[model samples]
Target: MSKLSISQAAKLKGVSTQTLRRWEAEGKLIPERTAGGHRRYDLAQLMGTKSELSFTVGYARVSSHDQKEDLLRQVEVIELFCASNGWQVEIIQDIGSGLNYSKKGLKRLINLITDHRVERLVLTHKDRLLRFGSELIFSLCEIFGTEVVIINRTEDSFFEEDLAEDVLEIITVFSARLYGSRSHKNKQLLQELKNVARQL
Candidate 1:
């Protein structure tokens, strides 16, 4: 009846440390407290057939670096949501275009899903996960036995604004690449043209 620390227990159970913590919060596996109030799991608990606990992960993202405040808000909301549910949550975040799948945080989340380490995934919005192909990820989660939770299901004015901004960013990139760099005078002329188009 050897007692193992959280890390050791997680290793024995083939799960992440976060998963073990979540299980503890969910009352799936109760660990004994050391004199110092540290958690110590009994090895037998890790090998128990009755414990079915898994980790819950929260993901947040903003499409632009300038939206740092929005990113923080998303994280705060996720933390509050998880806390309210009495869930121990691991939060993953990204500061990149939703169309970019190479973001480190996004990649890590996907890897966790693929490894079946995630029992549940919470996102502030579907677009926060990806601008497109989000259904593919959802399908993968289904196959991996991970549940998806979106904090916001209805589209809002903010979503429309973000979509328009993304469209403008794409247009700017293609416009620059196709027309090459413009002289200051030409740039001013283009701005004036944009203003005229807006007025129309």
Candidate 2:
């Protein structure tokens, strides 16, 4: 087997040198060390492998357009994290209620996962992906051999407030459908319920 230097190995793998280093550190790939203390990768192992390569992506979401700044901050953090790890990351952003899974960005993410193109997913927080049923997505990732990386565990109090609003919105929609939106009595009831929801 021929030996390849770090740069050559990185080029062959189509990843950055830092990524190669990280892989080594994570024991995913360990190179032979020279007497001069330089790392050398086996070219055959790096290039002749039959395993498929998958892509990495970062995802960010906000429950409303008012939280656009927060979403941008999440994107910045994800970009910085991927850059530090020397990963070329694709970022997906969504502006919608977490309770609603029909968002365009969320659908795109699911399609990518279904296509087996995603090797890894990075999220700022678990709730950033979904207000609920996040574990379901995690299970799908596991089935697809995709790794999930959550950068922060810190809870945002405002997220709970947003979730309450989402629940209220869902309730309002259903109630309107059941009671008839054109009814003045139903509209008054919805206004009263919304006021109560805001207080919660």
Candidate 3:
């Protein structure tokens, strides 16, 4: 019959305060409101059966096929982190430009989020999710009551290289659109861009 504050409840449940908030939004575990409108949870109720918990998702990505080794490393890190937290996680991996939204793995991840099948989404780094517009996905997670866990929030060393590749992808797409995909001009423009990127 003990009532616990949000933080206390989160600690007792081995999850984050944000995850508890998300659960509240999903109507999975609505808490009582204090006189100050703060959330309070029943200790026994907070420790729900494992069957009621949703699974966690670990997402790992690298910018190109050549970085397959790095992708595996990312997966390993995510797995170890989840294991340390005693979280049951499914790892989704992608080997493509971070700017590409149509990656099969990414699509699957988004579908899982929209379906509310994921309790949490873990990532090695923010940019691994996307080079740009990652906030949009994070917002979707918020709406779907999915908590996002970034293992390393600090800037990564290969960020510049990945960014350069993403930039090249953008230029390639635009150039193709402007002068047909098979056009000589498009090919020449892309080559020049690639050469410039190489110099930097």
Candidate 4:
């Protein structure tokens, strides 16, 4: 029932308005035309392309300090998957912690969903998009009929941090609370964890 203008649809699909217009002319991405000769796209149709539908939409996010510094690489991975399936992606970038909800980047992403511009959101990892409880985000996405996909769930042993990653992260947090320097507690936490291991 919801409709998006050609421009809006173009952005959601990661294409130009002219491309959409051209596609409409060539029957590539024909949206329902209004009486005024304007092209309007249906979000539902765009999401389900198998049954003669339109391009599906995808969302991606990452923090600033992540080792995967290049968000484009992440976007390309997502975009390639979507593109192969004739889907579109509206990528958003932000520089902050995943646990922080007041992220400007995430706010814009939520706004896009509110405007019915997103269908399925894709994240490389749950921690990339979220850290703690993300029930509110999931609930809003559900309410807006948007789905989420975590591309990678299994932990990567490649990271030198290994299983102690989360534990180290916790130590960092606690250290930050106790003292301004987080790295200061890393040595202590490592020693303590090693000591505890020896006792056990």
Ranking by lDDT: 3, 2, 1, 4
Q: Positional deviation of 54 in candidate 3, in angstroms?
A: 1.7
The true-versus-predicted C-alpha distance at residue 145 of model 4, in Å, is 1.2
Clashing pairs in 1: none
Runs with alpha carbons beyond 4 Å of true place in candidate 4:
1-57, 66-70, 153-200
Q: Residue 111's C-alpha lDDT in candidate 4?
A: 82
Cα lDDT of model 4 by residue, 113-186, tens digit: 67645556776555555556567777776776566666667853222332234344445565555554556666
Runs off by more than 4 Å, candidate 2? 1-53, 178-185
lDDT of 2: 0.79
TM-score of each: 0.64, 0.72, 0.76, 0.49
Model 2 TM-score?
A: 0.72
Question: Pick by lDDT: which candidate is best?
Answer: 3
Off by over 4 Å in 1: 1-54, 181-200
Q: Model 2, 100-188: lDDT tens per residue?
A: 88899989988887776776799989887788889988988877656788888788656867776687868766885857658888777
lDDT of each: 0.75, 0.79, 0.83, 0.59
Worst 10 residues of 1 by lDDT: 191-200
lDDT by residue for model 3 over 1-200, one digit each (tens)? 59999988876665667778777776889899999999989877877724254678999988888788888999999999998987878999988888899999999999998987787899989989888889999999988878899999999767978877787777876775756657787678778888887565
Give the local distance difference test score of model 4. 0.59
Q: Which has the better TM-score: candidate 1, or candidate 2?
A: 2
